[model samples]
Target: EEWMALRIGPVVNLPINHLAELSSKLDPDFPVVAVCNSAYRSSLAVGILQRQGFQNVASLAGGSQAWIDAGLPVYGTETQATVSAAPQRHVHLAERISAADLSRLMQDLPGTFDLVDIRPPQAFAEYALPGSRNAEIADLLSNPGYLTGAGPLVIVDRDGSLAMMIAGILSQKTQRPIKALQGGLD
Candidate 1:
């Protein structure tokens, strides 16, 4: 009950700009500790503060996970806090495709389209759509050499999720028309 009863000061949960504002109010030599759920966000906060010329800002090493793991109490309400939304980087791809449509696409492959398997290397080696070439999704972002410039590029994965992710990356990387094989290798 004492663990639950213990109350701590409110966490300085604010956007980067607010943190900068707070830093401006404090003496340049004063120390400040940034805390977050897993220290990841706090590490980001530390970077932001340091860039703003706050010379004494530090991130709490273990963060809130360490506090909870140590059996210490959490003082605040579980209600939502104000957080600035970050811009999303990944592209949104189409959802699932039908089995009938997949079969129709397969019959027309190798001539009208280029089948690029976007699954992991190990998975591709085990089993893949016949005549499909391996092009790991990660590699597509870094090395685009394996991709052909000839036909429409169709990305195939074990499931649609990986294919969609690769399609998004490919869309940004090349001028080639990209499409994901719906339902993947299934």
Candidate 2:
């Protein structure tokens, strides 16, 4: 079934909410295997699918690592699959920046860039970079109006991961450049 292939349901980009929507469209009776670079995301995907009533959802244990280790033939294609579900424009910053870089950015505070705090409202109210706007990462989709107007956007979270997540979503929705604070507020 190499070319015929196991009809994998949805290979979500990075957003967890998209996984939930994809799960709803899947054939519940058919087996679905969630895969990612590693098992972490796939496991999370499985959990999401399960909660959404996907009974036969399974995560590829050990993910692509186990498949490569087992000598399973991997498919490679230059052509990208166009997922209508994917947001039109989004920049993903997978690498973390340094504290020094963050300090310099803050000191300079680029005029065209808007600093957004992606942490919880409580955390942001307690302490955050001065003048940073609050927008919880989890509520980005629910509140589409969070980011308004046009400008480069910077997201600050308690940690780099949450910032990255919010950055991806904002990048998609706003079609604007989104950056994450290198070390967050730490």
Model 1 ranges with Cα > 4 A deviation: 1-99, 146-148
For model 2, how does the per-residue alpha-carbon lDDT over 14-93 read when each residue is reduced to its tens digit? 35557776566667788878776568888998888788777898889888778878887676534467767656753544
lDDT of 1 by residue, 106-166 (tens): 7865467667787778888899776678875567667766355776677778767788777
Go through the candidates in order and give each one's C-alpha lDDT: 0.68, 0.68
* lDDT score of residue 120 within candidate 1: 76
Looking at candidate 1, the ten consecutive residues that score lowest on lDDT are 1-10
Best by lDDT: 1
Best by TM-score: 2
Candidate 2: where is the Cα deviation over 4 Å?
1-97, 142-150
